[model samples]
Every structure is written in C-alpha cells, then in structure tokens.
Target: MAARTQATRLPATDLVRMGAIEKLTTRQDFETWSFLVTSMLGQFDLEDLIDSTIPRPAEDHPHHDRWSRLSKKVRCWLTLQIDSSIVRELRDESSTGWSIAYADETYEVIRRIIVGHAHTKAKSTWKSAIFMKREDYGSVEQYVTAFRQHVKAANLLKTPISPFCASLLLLEQLEKELPGWTGSIEAGFRSDIAETMTENEFHEICCAAIDEGNNDNADRSKPTSDKPRSSDPNGNTSSNLSSSSNGQTHIQKHRMAPPKGKSARQYVAEWRAHEPQRTPEGNYNYNIVR
Candidate 1:
C-alpha cells in the first residue's frame, strides 16, 4: 500500500467531519417531472426516461423538444443550483428582514470561507505556476487534483459544474453547519428587497410612498412615528396615509348631522352610553360596550 502521509490524511478528515462529504448525495428527495429533470440534471433515471415518452411543449416553442435536447443529469443539476444559492444567501447574518442577529456563528464562518480563499483559489494556484508542476494532468488541473477528493468523491472538479451541483453543495455546506439556518435564511432571502435599506433611505422611501398616493405601504417607506394620542390637539388624526402634518384630511371628512327626528332607543342608547356604564364602585366595565 502507498503509505498515507499526515499532510494528506489529516486535512481529508477535517473536510469529511465538516459534512462536506454529503455534497455528492444528489439523489433528490422528490420525484420531479421527467422532461424538467432531464433538462436540468443532464441525466435521468428509468422513471424519468419513461415519462418523457409523451410529447411536450408545442413544437413552435424555441425549445420545442427541450426534454429531448437536455440530458437528465443536466436538468437535475440546474434545478439544484438555483435552490441552493437562494438558501445560502437568505440564511446569512447580513441578509435583510428579521434583523435579529443569529444566535449561532456558523453563517459568519461559512460566508468568510466562500468570499475569501475559495474565490481566490484558482488565481492563487495558477499565478504561482503550480499547474506546471503537475503538467501530466489535464488543462483543468486545479480541480483534477483537488484537496477534498481524498475524503469524498465529488464531481465539483468537473468542467462547467452543473449549476444545480454547485447550488446543492453550497446549500449542503450551510445546512450541515447551521442546522436551523435554512428557515431564517429563506425568510431573509425571499422577502422584499426594501428590507435591506438604511434608516435614512427608509425616510426617502416614505416620501416616495406619499408620492405614490397610497398610504397602505407608508409604514414601510416612511419614518416611523409615535402612536398618535386621541386627546392631543390634533383631534384624532386621519389614517396615516391620508392625514397631513397639520392634522387636516386630504379628502373631506363627512360628518353626519345629528339625526333630524328620533330621540329613539338607539339615539338614547348612544347619548346615555357616552359615559360607559360604571360599576357600583364607579369603575368602567367594558363588557357593557356590547
């Protein structure tokens, strides 16, 4: 047996223990539509193959026989990539919405790992002329002899990694370390982009909202205000969307004149009820409002 060295074997375990080995588990949990999976994964299983027998997408569509055009494996991989990237971006601390800081630090670590060394790896190796030392290997030598392969066999080194595979691995890395990070990440990611804007920008947003002639979204766009008090000189301001700083309504407030006739039971009830019916001890009990 070729003797294993401390340098190679130790780093391999560091990767495997980190759950990087699960990156290759591409067997999807759900059975996807045949034509779709083949178009995405570049390969397909027997079930997928059988389903594509029926013709799909009208012939006039640019990709009329898309099912036939793409291999099953390609289709599967593409789909996986989209899902995984979305998961990773949303789960990180810097993501918008739910501004509460994460209770765990894994997202911080993962973000650093991806944005720093991994991004520079290719250039770092190539600029140093390391590939010249391994000239017997193929042109894509950086991946052909990657460090993680000794611990786990992954096709990450393959040319044009299926977006799905890249996405899947990215998601898998986050999932392994962060555990419950997906829900928070997804919440942050899928939310409206406005969530990420600064407070001053949020003020400008309110001006934009008033310009839109809709207060329904004013809170999100404008500076938050303290709850208006009923007894204040403003005399019960209109809905924030319609209310002006002077407490005047942009639209006329139609005050109904007192009913011309009936000092009837309804009117009597309102007049008498103006002061809530109080208890024997003189405290108001809200149950009487009914």
Candidate 2:
C-alpha cells in the first residue's frame, strides 16, 4: 500500500497576526484607521480579531478578560504611533468603555479619537496660514501664490481669507516699499474698493502701484532738461535763479525736506509738523498758512 500523505499547516507569522497595523505607525492616525478598516473588512471583523490576537493576563488578574486585553493592546499600539499625551488622555477616558461589546461600538470610539486628532492638527495649520506674512522684499504675486498654497495645505477653503482682508495685509507690507502709491490705495480701500475687489484685482493693483512707483523714481532721477540751455545774454548764468533761490529759502525757513525712502505716514507726519498753526476750531489760520 502507498504511504498516506499527511497535510501540513503553517503557523501564522507575526506580519499576518499584526496585519497592516504594524506598517500604519508611519502614517497619520486618521489615514491609518481609514486604511485599516478598508483593507481588513473582507478578511475578518476588526474588533473580534483584535480581541482574539491580544494576550490576556493570568486568571488571577482583575482585568484579565478579552475586552480589557484588547483595550490594553490597542493603547499600546496607539502609544507607539501617536503622541504620549494623546495616549494618556485616551487611557484616562477609556474611550472604548467596558460596556463596548460590539465591533460597531469599538469602531465608533476609535473613529472619534482619530477625528479629534485630525481636527486639532487642521486647526493649528489654519492658524499658521492666517498669521502668514510676506517675506522681506518679496513681490505681491509671490506672496499671494504662497498664501494660496498654505491655505490649500491647511484645508482652509471653508473659511478662506476675504479679498479685502488679504488686500489690507498686502498693503501693510507694500506701504514700506511704495509709500506714496500705498497711501492712495489706502484711501480707495476705505471707500468702495474694499467691497468690490477680488484677490486677483488686488494683486493687479499692487503690480500697477509698483510699476508706477518705479516710473516716478526713474523720472525724478533724470535731469529736468537734457539739452544744454543757451548762455543767458543778460548776466543770467542760470535759468530761473530767482525762483530757485526763493524756493530754497522757503524750504530752509520751514525745515521741509523732500521725502526719500520714507513711509507715507512718516512723510506726512513731517509735513504736518512744518505746517502753520491751526485755530481752536480745527481750521487753519490764513495768516499763518503757507
């Protein structure tokens, strides 16, 4: 007679017993939980598998039941993956209470824990996006692009920054670079511009202001007359000498200096300081006015 063949069964490996939970430590808790639930649904009931796989204490131990063992093992796994503070809070709360006997209840508790963590992380991201400021010397276009990226990463579309608020923030930084242009923009912001503008419109406005400022600076640096003036026949070596001298004298008397690399607010303050005295009724005195 031929020898009878015996069937051999292989014991489950550690990888099989742990399932995907072992690899989940590197992922966010919300993603891990989602992947775990989706991948394991057809194989076995998650709660039942967890209860059976986790080791129970000796019979003498007070909390030696399957539920207690499962809870302990779950906590241990979570501690390895998440922050110790979150684990400790979960432990104190006993999120999956002793009364939780069904798989649905276990899943609900776990879902809540993961969702809570996700919410906290999202909130921190939102705060960072809201407080974001433009880098020194950065362009308005660059700043807006960076802001959009941050808002998307933080999942802040539900509470996006208003165009007016974004414009105001951009103006704050632009004021330092384009004081005169920003002063005019500020006046518009206080009027109907704030309500009707979009982020793109604001960006365009900033770009225009920058261009205008550059042109103004270029014009100011150039000589008033490129061609040499013919020599004055009547002992007038310089043209408009009288007007120039009078203007210089007036500037000296009032201590008025041309604005150079100063913010609008600073320049305005200086100009106001040199102005004639005002009456008690807040009106300028014609006698003292320039």
Candidate 3:
C-alpha cells in the first residue's frame, strides 16, 4: 500500500451541502447542525434536526428522549474529529436536559451513518490491504506496517472508520496474544473465523463410514440356514453356523449361485461398453470401476 497524503481543506459550499459546515456560530444556532448529523446516522429527519437543535418547543417529539441519551456520545466523538462547533453542540446536547425525542433520534442516526459507512469502506480497504499483506507474508512487521499504511491510505480517501478501528484492533490483539503461532500476517488478518477440520481428520471420518458400510454389506450377505426348508419337514437336522472372514455368521450348507447371463469378465466388459451408467434412480452419471 502507498503512503497516505495529508488532509486537504474542503470547499465551504461542499461542506454546507453535506451539512458538515454550518453558518450557526452561537449555541442557539447549532440546532440545525445537530439535526443534520443525526439524520445522516438515520436517527432524525430534517425537520427534527432544526427543532431539537434550536430547542424549538413545538417541534419536539415524545420519542426523542431515548435518542438524546445515545446521540450525545457519538456526537461528541464526531465533534472532536470534525472541528466543527455544531458538531460540538450536538455532542453537548446529548444528555444535558435534552428531550428524549432529540436524543434517541440523533443517537440512532449518527450511529447508523457511522456503522454503515465505516463497514462499506472497511470492506474495500481490508480486502486490498490484506491481499497486499498476504503477498508479503514472510515478515510480520512488514505486514502490520503495510496494514497501518493501508488504514492511513483509507483515511486519506475520506472513508468513515471509528467503527472499523475496533475490529482491526481486536485482530491486532489476537496477534499479541499468540505471538508464537506466527507465519503470515496477511493470513492472520484474512483467514475466516470459522475453523475448518484438517483434511486428514475429514478423511478419517470418511474411512470410518466406509468401514461401517462394508460391515453392513457383509452382514446382509450372510446365508440364512436357520430358515425353514421343505426338505426337512420334521426339522430333525440343524445347520452349523460358522464365523466368516467378513465377521458374519453363515451356514456351511448354503450354496453359491452360478453367474447368470455371461461370465464375470465378459459381463464386466459389456457393462463398461455403456459410456455412462444409469443409477437405480434413472439418472445418467459417470462412475469409476474398481
């Protein structure tokens, strides 16, 4: 990742359009700004922004009490970062005798905007940053340095973060906690949280299933000499049961049926002639012969 450039001064007109810049210089005039910032977070509407920030009596809503409490924290954080008085007013209003209608609305809106925008930006930034880090997986220091560079790069791009930083910090903490398990920094950052079973472990499960299947087949193949036969009306003769190599008890008297239709080799050849085999379900699919 490339180094991030310094922040530049944005035009006043653009700031005003985004509601980041306000004409209000006094405490009373800052109400409009509070409302606008709240709306961006999806907490309040344009009308509410003006009324609550201005402390206009008629414009207040009953529901804003809850919002007021929540919006204060976010507004304060935003204010500190933005260097705007209106932002400060919103932050200050968060709990200071503010109506619930104003607080809840502002809190929700600002939180939403921060969360939603930060997530969107973080996804793009993390992907690019992590990919580059992966390419230089041999050195952990280099990976972290690159990651930080990417973050600075993202900030330079005017991306919202306050929300994203925590997740990244947690990832950093994980590295600190397990310093010995180091390999690739990018791999650490980019790997999915859900741990997958190793291939050998998975194959053992399959092998166990196969063994069970063979055992079931052997049991089914056992001859049933105990079955009543017409030849022994009095049932004077009893069949001898012996264990077979397949772990199945079978009667010695049971005879094997002769191969039908064609010889084993010939039958196999004929079966192979059919390019694709049709399963019992009548679906044509490829199969491998052992």
The most accurate candidate by TM-score is 2
Residue range 1-290, candidate 2, lDDT tens digits: 42211101111222224343433222245555545654553252233433323433445554335434444444444345445554555465465463234333443344445443356677776676677776732555565556555554454323456667666765676676567777887776646765777757755765675576567657769977653322322433332223454455222122233445777687667667875655455544331111
Which stretches of model 1 miss by more than 4 angstroms?
1-62, 65-86, 90-121, 128-290
Instruction: Give the poorly placed runs of model 2, Cα more than 4 Å off.
Output: 1-125, 135-141, 148-157, 190-200, 206-290
The candidate 2 region of ten consecutive residues with least summed lDDT is 2-11
Clashes of each: 24, 0, 17
What C-alpha RMSD separates each model from the true structure?
A: 24.8, 20.3, 20.1
Number of the top-ranking candidate, with lDDT as the measure: 2
Model 2 residue 242 lDDT?
30
> Which candidate model has the greater TM-score, 1 or 3?
3
Superposed Cα RMSD, model 1 = 24.8
Per-residue lDDT for 241-284 in model 3, tens only?
A: 56889999976664322244557686567657867545454644
Q: Give the TM-score of candidate 2.
A: 0.30
> Which segments of model 3 are wrong by more than 4 Å?
1-81, 85-123, 134-139, 148-290
User: What lDDT score is found at residue 201 in candidate 2?
Assistant: 76
